[model samples]
Target chain A: MPVTAVLHTETRVVRRLTTDFPALIAPDETAVDVTGLDINLSGGFTVLELDNSLRPASPEEALESGVDEAAAGARRKTRHRAASVALGAAAADPLSHTSLREALTKLRLAMYGE
Target chain B: MGLSVKTGSFVTETATGSKAYTGLGFQPKVLLLWSVGGVTAGTFRTGAYTSVGFGTDSTHRAALGWSSQNGQNFSNCARTQGPNVLDLVQWDVTTHIRADLVSMDSDGFTLNYTTVNATAKIVHYLAIGGSDITSCTVLDWPCGVATGNKVVTGVGFQPDAVMHLSIGEPSSGSSLQADARLSFGMMEAGGGQWSNVIYSVDNSGTSDSQRHQQTGKCIQKLTTTPSVNMAAQFVSMDSDGFTVNFTSVTGVAERVFSLCLKGGSHSLGSFSAITSGGPAQDSPSLGLAPLTYLLSSFNSSGQASPIGSTRWSLGGSDGTSEETAWANDTDALGTSASDTLSKTDKAIVICSATPAVLGEADHSALGSDVFTLTWSTVPVTAHELLYWAIGAGAAPAARIPRWLPVMRTHDPRPLDAVA
Candidate 1:
């Protein structure tokens, strides 16, 4: 019989549910107005103004703000270190297909924290 | 998923004037490319799988649509291999897309396409509204002539559009000749919009046409009599000058009187004495000397203030010695020579009298120098009656008998003492 480690370590999986997705687009046909948002989300997530009062934080936002303090800081440092490594790899081997993909993936992981 | 595949940038050019695109190995999706003078390149794509080529002989090009042949790989389908024609190419895709091609070399060129819609031509004039005509060679239309309002349909090099003008009744009391200056011009009916074309109808000088000459009734006959009797008298015998004292009535100040011999029938020199008396004689004389000199200074309101004193010499060299003597006496007595005497000689004597008194004398036969002495004296003052000595000599001098009340009698008095 294989012994399974039944030790329950707390692993937080924060989920933010958003049903009104179209509201992510600006109501005005022209450029978006994001002055109300405290955090800029256009880099990755499409920030939405769903209702006047309710604005739940997204998954990306939770990961950014909800991690354990020391671990969260380590993760941030690790992400910055990974981005710098990927940029060095891209510069060294720009034409190498493998290096390009690896660098792009690292960059995405750093931004989205996958 | 088995294999998701995408294909790209396959270009083909045709030979000069070759209208049909024939065999290229695999029926790869076709995109036509054209280059003009190695400078410009244009591409056109035929949606999915298709092939294009130029016919060896025919001018019309062909775009062949292909469905996959059984068991055929994408490579096996015909593909346009290299470049095509080296000259201009034109094609019509469906109905609306029309394109023209120019080929520079084996590798480059441009395709120009135009989409067109059908339209009709509209004609326009230089001056849409009308043109203003200042003068014209022919004065066919005159101003103020009214024509029935109509749309300004068209205009010509010369003013066209037949116009019916109402010349209105010929200027009142004027003869209507064919050649008169009949005013005629186009005008919008109802609205007083005048036409830009105005002209005068003159009968080109050959015809007898009269221009409008303004005539009016002789200025209302001014039968003005001196408000007070004129101080000067008309004398026919002596030809001695006289003094005229003109006192204007309140409203009569505006009246201007010109003194000239009436018909040129008689010879009388210009005015010698023109003095203005006051409102009433007792009010004092507003003497107007050299009336001609002061005519311009008369106030526009017609107020006759004292201009200055004026005197007429009765017995100067222009008169006989007796007249001269009379004028001297008159000057001494502070009386006008014209007021007291008829014959120049006695006029001198009477005018010279101290405390000049009225005189009586026969003045009937004083020949051609017949004169009428007229004047208004001071309102309430006592005046001695005076007369003229009729004969030439100074022998029998005449005197006026009674005291004449001022402003009363129009008779002449002499300077001789009464019996």
Candidate 2:
């Protein structure tokens, strides 16, 4: 008898974040100009207005204190919380016969960081 | 491991005439070692050979001589069978022989039965020989072979099937090589068969046959330069727009730009007809009376002043105003000598005489001649005009006026007198 062997495996990762934030508008505002808002996720996460007048606040504080009153002053300001999430899966030796259940189990473990 | 022949018993036999009676019975078991040569041989012997005698009877004598030697005389001889014993003659013999014996030849005189046995081993060797056959056939060729044991006479007897055969090496050092070539040729004489020829014509390379050439009179090219200056030079004789030919500083020769005076009070009624290399003819001549009051500007936006070359300002109304000073530059005929024109200034011409009424006869009409000419004492006007007589022998005459009262007065006369 002759024998042949093949191997297959897969890896997956998923990261998720969710938060609430506050938005502000002037009392006599017609349309909100959000073009100046910059959301940077390159180094951790940070959100800022292109204009110098606004100030930043924590995600918790932004949700606790609403945006309407905080933006009422002359130099209006608001706090917004942003989340960056991703999910990905990769496989090796995919052509080989292997237990799909086992590959999926490994992928799930990798995604959950368990 | 060694062979030892022992005599168990012996007896004497006497034959008296044909009736030799000898009751001799002794077990004679001979261990035979047979050697045979050649290709066809058996691996083992089937039956047993023994030597014994019970009586001198013919049937018993044959059996007793089973151990007798027929031709060669030897001091020690292996057991042999007589020619008359046909049953034992057909036994197979093999090459290479060895034997171990615990029995001996004996003659008995009423002996009880005793058993003797011997062990022998025979070995056989075999060799095989073979030769190879060679065959080949072209691909896709129709071929057949006989289906049954009967000889096939015609093509109909052969059945269709793929013939698969193998080729073997003819000799140990020989090598086989096969070569083949495939070629194709096509000829197209006088448009050969369309089916056999491949055609890839690109009709897109040719111009579309459906396109039609535009039919109309040649249009003249109009060269125009927009201006903001109210006092721009112009050639007045060109009823059409005037063409200004200027040599570019960059060595471009004879670049022409046209300038036309728009008419009406607002100078707003501008007509842009196509112009050619030479003077362009006026097409559908527009009425210039309505554009009199229009402030003419050199630029399309009309934001700058046409006079003094600056910001927008009201064009003066009076004929002597600076804005209207463009009129002072007019020629003797009251047409602008240069291309410039004042804002409020305009050219005016007055006719010296009124045209005569038809069908009213009087002293001025002259008598009822076939062709008559009437003369006006008024001075010759300063304009070109043509007159026609609606009678026999009458022809029109062109009148060029230079002054109002220079010509002599004369009474009505006949057409011949005027001629």
Candidate 3:
């Protein structure tokens, strides 16, 4: 099952339980199925707050959420860097180039309202 | 049966209700729980607290819990009723806002709370499971009763280890009071004893002073103001329970709670060395491989300028997983703090999750029965370090003697050829 919401309580932060664990595992919800393997919940896990969810969060969901947050931050930084580069180029050789002047006008229109 | 130990954490339920924590493959015979500090709603008391319970069922178990608050003055409260995990703002045990272990079930355990409206906090627990756990009991001793050795029996079996905690709510309020003393000590058979005690005096609730004493004695009460001197020294681990000698004749009837653990493969001992910020050195052998171990250190000089410092770490494997906490009082300031990173450099650290964070020492257990410790940074003022270790693992097989068979003279068997 996929984890929907991370429960942030006053005491601890809870996400979803996963098979793999880091060296220091924060305690989580109890009871793990021990059908085929000898491992138990003692390996350490995170708690996922659900109305009735029991299964753990899948790998794909974890990866997708991690990548989504990283990519979103990168995209925002990239746009800010592009705007700074354009402004720098116009300031350097604005009087000599007609293309640069036209580009600055378009850039200004995109950045500002009118 | 062999021993199995598991560590985990959980958050107490907020609403009025009970919760059972499962997933422990086997039923635990003994459970040790502590309050791991975290952000919480409402005015929660911030400090350290611990509780230990032993039993297979609810009615037959025994538990003792105590908490220490290092605020205006060091205030401590203890309860003898099952293992109760108190919420924040609960310095008084009379309040119904607490979590108590109700029963030890087949898989995990259950906790019943007084009210659901109390603030929740993170609790870390270590549970031990095995048939070798023959006896898990608690003993209470009235301090300053007499000035002689008192043997504590009725444990049924010699305990492998014991934990001591002083019970009573000693506070700092309107009057100049001198009752609050919080001490935590653990000792393992064949190993060393380590304990940290903090004694504070509330003078008119305005001016307060705390004495952080690190001594071999698990339960010690010594103060200059109001002239109170007493120490409950752990004499030895005996055939049944143990023995404690009281060194004072008169003092408050402060009670001491002890949790005795018998069974399992445990090695307990202490070593002494000077701090020079050196390489990793192997500790004296424990004679058997250990899966996990706890290391504790204190100044050998007893109480002084850095009045009795106590530092300890829990470590496992290539020393990668480790947790360290320390409490020390700088006599000049008359202030003491535990789990604080700034004052760690003054003392030596054996092992830490973040070695750089402590910047004193780091420790890792070797594959064999011994572990290695290294001091990352030399102390500004060098002092003797008394390190105590308690290692737990599978019990080793008993040794069998080899006897030489008698050879008849007529047989003419060579001495070297005897089987």
Candidate 4:
């Protein structure tokens, strides 16, 4: 039982899309949560670190990390949606664990941890 | 996918758009590099690695650089000026770095840049690391002739946060015209600590406000100067990494960006000084546990009452901008608010708790100045914001440090650092 991961933070006012003229704005959002991590944190977190994991892939993982090209699939114009909408309704609110996956699982447990 | 992030892309030729572009596996504490230019300049580098590979018994690094090149905009070290010089906000060039993360393979580390290029620049770097990052010092330098106040010292340890950036100034025009600036700063290392200077441009480029205005130039100060002396080229901070005092150093040569963050590095949890009579107020409750946040309405929103992210605007109030970024949020704003509010604009949100978070699980019911517009009708401004919280508790530290020459090499492949 040497597994520890308890980090939680959730502040919301959500909605943002500024340019003015009713472009939409709520601003004042914050998120992070991990209660015990086995899986399912809730939705609302996005905390990356750990060399961002070597960054460079998100056009569907850059075409499965092969990166065919088209400006590298344009670096993600589509894909990245099952849900996870930048916190709007807190991503969908599964109890809100801070979404973006789980901030990608916290960047892969910060580069492969537990 | 827990935290150690990584993303790469580079294309700036004309003979090495400066230099030092590593694999970014460890030698990074927190480096973000983006590009989209107009009235541009050159010079770049941002690092954090305490013992990665470089003379002095082989490893120690912390970096930041900026070069506008033209009679050299006078002050630098990724910028640190307390006097004047800033007001160009054109478009794209958002860079933010936080350092400390050593052990690079077998003595490997370098993120170089010395100036050269006003064209072919296509960069998109993002390297994040873990293990609560212990150390990294990137104090790069380049000031050809005239000198006076510019200091960067032995950052052996002792650093919670400090950032500054400057390249070579002179180029506040070209394009749809907004406010072209390439100077940046943000801080947190101790008391009197408050530093911000940004102008991320996105003036009605309208791709969702260019995805978040990305412009406005920044300014923030509450300096005590730990060892700083940078006439503010762009950004500034403390905890050993420049004790600058170059009242005037010409011949165009100023490029500095110093980053140092020990453990977590991101202090000051909550602060909401937004009193004016808005029909929407609530910000008097952040004691911690509420992650993510960084704002600047400094001396109230500009443009005759323009602070309406959620409220504090009655000049022509337009609520509900409908959005909530954090699919991995990273922001750099300051396009207009009368130009980043003069001094007082900074946001470094990454949370879990701290800032004096009380109990009941440390409450984060999220109630900051919850306004909608109505502060005595309109005009008592300074649309405030200053929240700095990071991570939450401390987790990431499983891999990265893979370069065994053997010296305490535990080998199960989890934690075995040595540069």
Candidate 5:
């Protein structure tokens, strides 16, 4: 499953410095889950157009890519830790619900491939 | 190690002092700032001042600034005055104030300026960060009174893009009354496509401003007669920078400041507005997804649609902030506003007296290597649009297998069996 985090946007921008992973802000308040990507929120936002290949994959993807189950689990743990911190940071802001909605929607798609 | 960018604004100190803009998260390799001085009350007029600087450290850097004085007078600091990035003065050159980027720090940069003139200058800046940038160069060239190509070289590498400013020496000495031009030119590496907007102010009697915009031209001098009516075009992207061909010229050598870039994916070209069929238009394929883009419009023959009007826009996503600056002779005014609905394709350019949308388009979708420009209202006649796009780098051509087939940890067969 994909990890989740809320992101705050100022003028629709989320600073990359606010998160550990590469973050993509949603176009609007409507949260979007671009699975394999990271999230966060802050100011001085510059939209970054990233190469899709570099995105981080879920544990299932790691295993599918031929990694051992233990290795995939380790990757999951790392992602979880990073997401937890990002989530806490974004949730602290009252204006992060839309970002959260986008993030949750992305997470749901990643989890169920919906 | 690829190029990354950040945009923000700051107000210059009322008193002469040093200040730092921190929290950028990455050290910037180059900085470009345009004065938003006219937006607030007691502020300077917009486009009156602009600056560009480069270097990772203060000790080994170069900077330049160009400003237009109200009486059709102007001045520029080109790597002189000890590394200062800005030199600003009031309508007349009285208490000349200066500022410098003294340090380029890990997280941000520092600026040291002079004097509290009561009114502070609000500056908008774009900072480019990354180690992969091959070079960031500043060039000050002269556009003399003669019609010919003025090829600018010495960048040391084929630059991907360039920004130009036109500052001519005052026809009369210290009095500083004459014609000055504030120009912005965008040129791409591929095909040498170019587009530019030149705003010239002639303070002969009253403050008279002329807007000269063109799609296929670069550095141009369009002041009233006897002042060198010059028009230039992009020649080629040379190995050691690029070249410009000034087809028409006359007058003393006018100074031009250029900030050139090397190492980054850049796409620049022009397209015409649709007046037939449908209102949908697509820019020439950039071959990559762009992070930011600038679009400006001109007439079919490379002049403003209404002849004496001006319009240009800069846009990017993040909640999508689009900034537009427009002016016309009737109003004799220039103003900018932030539009949140701006996207890669959904941006418009207008040059009406009321600044109504002569041509309106919204970014419909960003494709793999192209974006769709869906016009809300097509122009009554065809207009030309010049656009420049910057990308972090090219996208991967295809998804490679995430991993080569690896042997199972508990594989019964020998590891070398498959090999």
Candidate 6:
């Protein structure tokens, strides 16, 4: 990450959430604003934008729209088979350790407020 | 082979020294020290490295957090000064380099300056090593002191070695102190050269005659380090970021400091003698990533005593290893958290506290600072404007995204009010 710590995402908010997704993270006096989130996202309406290229080898337009049948070639030939099916579905996740200890106990109860 | 960079400078008189091969050739794994001040007083250990070790086992070593004098100037940086320590400035200091002193048989490596009243003067060295550098990062902090034709946007990866130091303001009105230091590297000769060291405080032999300015070659890809015949001005070198116009020959109110090194793509990574910082042999840009840099401390033209240090000591001591998967996911850009930039250059992170161990270590996994993530809007050369990366759960999904959503950062404990 010495690639100058990688954050080159200059002003490009192309939103499209549908219901409510906020809580991406907050502080600096609780700063959230996913268009002031109301709440929604089982994976229905999701189109947010901030791009610079995720480079974990997706994107030939996310392999022509979310890995469509490995999208018939191109993009350095499906980037080594989408980095081997996204690292074999994250090493065949078996609920990866109780979803990582319940996301570190909801991140230690939202970072120790209790 | 891959990353090898070399350059030399010596001036201590009463304390210590070393350098000059007559023909040098190759072998050195890493070394970067810059004093410019006078090395005010005590501190700066390890000299005879057959493996290459000088500073960074976690601060207090690189001669009191890398001094130009304590902040009279550091690469041209003082930034209000006080012990920010820039996360002990590392990635280049896998805990204070000393693998055996990284190739001492031939290509340079051995610097010792402890104390004798500390005021001999002149210290500017950059000696890298190569077995095939594999991966590297060295930016040496201090990013402001501008005016005239300013550009500087290096350090975003893709360098084969680049260095620049424009220090002025140690004496107020700035008349002339030799050439007033303006160095550039990435040379095998003929192609890259632009010199002017701390020849006491700046002296191109007396007055910037022609130290070495082949065409004043810069660097790029922006980071690669290794050196045989680099002979650079590389232009794009690889271009993840590059732009350094610089115009401080007394451009006005003068104060500048730039050091960029990304050594080795190798076609040539050794050779020196066009002048300036001359006689280099090349090597040092080891195992890629971790130069988040920002540490400083200076003192000496008068006395208060503060010395030198250059870290990013670059990897080795794995819990998992690719250097710890590039130091665990270096998120650099994930986007959103008011827009980003508040990760405040503390720079060093190592195993990333934990995300099940993050990336497993290759080098670099720092991010989460830069404020509202705004950057006013890109292109000042754009190395992510100055820092980025914000994806872990809620969004920002990509642009360098990886993950880091623990209420955005740390938890000394006091959050949880948002329901």
Cα distance off (Å), candidate 1, residue A113:
99
Instruction: Estimate every model's Cα lDDT from 0 to 1.
Output: 0.18, 0.16, 0.43, 0.27, 0.47, 0.23
Report model 6's TM-score to 2 decimal places: 0.24
Number of the candidate with higher lDDT, 5 or 6:
5
For every candidate, what is the interface RMSD in angstroms?
Answer: 54.4, 47.3, 25.9, 23.5, 29.3, 26.8
Per-residue lDDT tens digits for candidate 4, residues A1-62, read 12111111121111111112222112222222211323211122222223221122234432
Residue B368 of model 4: what lDDT? 28
Estimate the overall C-alpha local distance difference test score of candidate 6. Answer: 0.23
Interface RMSD of 5: 29.3
DockQ of each: 0.00, 0.01, 0.01, 0.01, 0.01, 0.01
Once fitted onto the true fold, the runs of candidate 5 whose alpha carbons sit more than 4 angstroms away are: A1-114, B40-84, B87-89, B94-98, B144-151, B170-178, B199-207, B226-228, B271-284, B297-306, B309-367, B371-385, B394-419
Model 3 residue-pair collision total: 12
- Model 3, residue A59: what's the lDDT? 41
| Model 1 misplaced stretches (Cα beyond 4 Å) | A1-114, B1-249, B252-353, B356-419
Ten contiguous residues minimizing lDDT sum, candidate 2 chain B: B210-219
lDDT of 6 by residue, B1-419 (tens): 34344444344435433223322256544444443222321122211010111321122111212111111110111111111111111111111111111124464544332222233433433444555443344333332222112333444555544443332222321112211122223321112232211111110011111112222333210100001011113333345434443221111222322333333322111111011211111111211232122111010111111111111111121111111001111111111000001011112111121211111111122224211111111112101001111111211212221111112222222122212
Q: Interface RMSD, candidate 2?
A: 47.3
Residue-level lDDT for B323 in candidate 5: 35
Q: Supply candidate 3's per-residue lDDT for B78.
A: 23
User: Lowest summed-lDDT stretch of 10 residues in model 4 chain B?
Assistant: B339-348
Q: Which wins on lDDT, candidate 1 or candidate 3?
A: 3
True-contact fraction per candidate equals 0.00, 0.00, 0.00, 0.00, 0.00, 0.00
- A best-first ranking of the candidates according to their TM-score comes to 5, 3, 6, 4, 1, 2
Q: Higher-DockQ candidate among 2 and 4?
A: 4
- Judged by DockQ cut-offs, is candidate 5 incorrect, acceptable, medium or high? incorrect
